[model samples]
Target: MAAWGQRLAGVRGVLLDISGVLFDGAEGSGVPIAGSVEAVARLKRSRLKVRFCTNESQKSLGDLVELLQQLGFDISEGEVTAPAPATCLILKERGLRPYLLISDGIRSEFDQIDTSNPNCVVIADAGESFSYQNMNKAFQVLMELENPVLISLGKGRYYKETSGLMLDVGAYVKALEYACGIEAEVVGKPSPEYFKSALQEMGLEAHQAQ
Candidate 1:
């Protein structure tokens, strides 16, 4: 533990994972991990830069802020980093309409985008909405488009829910990929680009963050 601390001693900025670290989504809602709020307060007291990084694609940034606040975490919208913003940027750059397969809770995040002639299938944690009909619709969209793309917010396999381990979006993304014979573009955590962006947002180089 001492060696571990030494290794992370000079980290100017801390990028923290939201699920399983700060809180657990056991009940389908964030259940704050013991000491998490106080730990964050301590980090703030230390004047260390902190950012919450999550692969959760089921909530908008605003919604995440609210949830964190409600759970007694001192976090602002700016301090939260999730895949939605980056995904939106990619969508805009590619100029592709989205055939979204995300949760209704997060649908508003893509409200301004055009979906009239979708050529991209964006899959995320659609929860109960990941039904056969919706999957078929997304698959159909991909097949029909001249050169469609498959975008996955994150490729996490499972998450701990109140009901125990539950399948995450990766499973569904893989299924779609299998059916369509196209690989998904993952744009969330574990992606080097995503890490770089988060570090950049902290005004630090990659080496300065941990």
Candidate 2:
């Protein structure tokens, strides 16, 4: 798993995790944490691929690009994963459009999911992106579908930010599951599905992992 994290100083290769790995602390301070941004720039100079695999869940690549730029890290939309897009890709491929419950930015990506189908993928991310209305619809849809697929398996509560510790998306996800009486399907990595996809994206062969 990339969770072990590739060595930043030595490798002229993939750089996963944008905020903490590239910049210091968390959002706002935008200060480069001890050689983090430099490490990325160094890789870029050396032509190494820096793919930022984020469980960020919400926010579009454009938003990420702007934030990265604020911190003086030169990044593009291509090297990021906000999960919403990946979710849409999954549901679309499954031939199902999900009635999503997530942040505003994340909801944009749901356009790709086929809402007309009975199987609706209910989604949620951190922050105030989700609301009562969305959750209501999400539960209603789940009741109809009986087992709505969840996009994120992560239940992490709060991440450290420049300001301080804050709530993470997991809380809201749990709330929906409680109301809907269904569990979510995790689509991204660390989950075997996502982890394998990361490896495949990196063009690495998967051996037996303990």
Candidate 3:
């Protein structure tokens, strides 16, 4: 084995970030970053397992994957570990109905989840939907719950777009937490369990992935 191969001898899986990696913040499918499309294709052909992890909550998992494919990246929905799907799993497991304050594009990911008589609040990047009316509704749900639960898809402060940095779910989550005097359970990146879930999906332990 060569020097780089030796260094990666124990590595069984690789995690690639989606946004700002394979694609830029442009509108539509977004422009592919320089050489990223080929890089991803090469990685897919490599021996190491590959997984795309993202904190993106603006679109559904399927939509995101479709966009990547449209950009000429060899990616599929199954190979991507996204926040909305993970958050849905959390919601189902907890049997918690939510007052969802999320993007319209990503709502289909939570179609199976119950929102009737919400006992908790689930928030994400609602874009223009993050109005005072919507925020207040989410806050009201949390306040009514005897035990408040706030589930954030990703605790990202902001993300870059063609227009520049835009606010993410973390900021909104903080606002609700402050008003409700409760903490949120983050379901995406920077959370140990989130990374663990990706590792688990790849059938690789923490040390086995790069």
Candidate 4:
């Protein structure tokens, strides 16, 4: 415990995962975990800087923030780093027009991007939108492209929600990858760059947070 404390002494920032840690996914009626709100408040009061990082793509950033606030979390839209926004930045930077296979809630994030004549596919947690027809359509687009590009918001296999374990975007992404013989570029959790970007936003170095 002493050695662990010594190592943590250098920590200056905290990156909190929104789902599972704070609450269980359930659209607008998400249930918060016991003490998570108070824990977040304590973290905010501490010397360490805090940032909410999530792979949530089914809802807009504003909506997500509003939900958290309603659950008594003192969160702001700016302090949260979600996959949809990050994916948007990447789409703009690469100038790739994507045929989005994402939820309608967060579609506004890519409003500025051109979806006409899509050269790539951006798949996220589309919830019920991940229909057989939609998947086949995305597969067709990728197969037709000379250079198929698949951008996955996150690669989580599954996540626990209020009801039970629910399928995440990774499963669908892998299916497309297998069919198209192409790998997807993951832009959310488990991506080192994503964590780095969150830490950078908190004005801290990699060594300062774990």
Report lDDT per candidate: 0.86, 0.63, 0.89, 0.92
How would you encode candidate 1's per-residue C-alpha lDDT over 1-210 as one tens digit per residue? 999889888788888888778887744367899999999988878767888888988778888778778899999988877898889999999897899999988898898788877888999899888999999999999998777699999999998875689889999999988998888899898788988888888898877787
Ranking by lDDT: 4, 3, 1, 2
Choose the strongest candidate by lDDT: 4
- CA lDDT for candidate 3: 0.89
Candidate 2 per-residue lDDT over residues 1-210, each given as its tens digit = 464554333444463776556764444236677877777777778656556776665566576678778777877786665566666677667777666665666555565555775577556563665667766776677777755666663556766778878776677778777877777676655566665565556554444221
Candidate 2 deviates by what RMSD? 4.8
Please, what is the TM-score per model?
Answer: 0.94, 0.77, 0.95, 0.97
Query: Could you give the C-alpha RMSD of every candidate to the true structure, in order shown?
Result: 1.5, 4.8, 1.6, 1.0
User: Where does candidate 3 stray beyond 4 Å?
Assistant: 1-6
For TM-score, candidate 1 versus 3, the one ahead is: 3
Off by over 4 Å in 4: none
Q: Model 4: clashing residue pairs?
A: none
Worst 10 residues of 1 by lDDT: 20-29
Sort all candidates by TM-score, best to worst. Answer: 4, 3, 1, 2
Best by TM-score: 4
Whichever of 1 and 2 has more TM-score, that candidate is 1
RMSD of 4: 1.0
Please write out the lDDT profile of model 3 over residues 1-210, one tens digit for every residue: 599888798998899998988888665558888999998888889998999899988898888888888888888888989988888888888899999999899999888999999989989888888999999999999999899999988888888787788888889999999999999999888999999999999999998998
Model 4 Cα lDDT, one tens digit per residue, 106-163: 8998898899999999999998899999999999999999999999999989988777
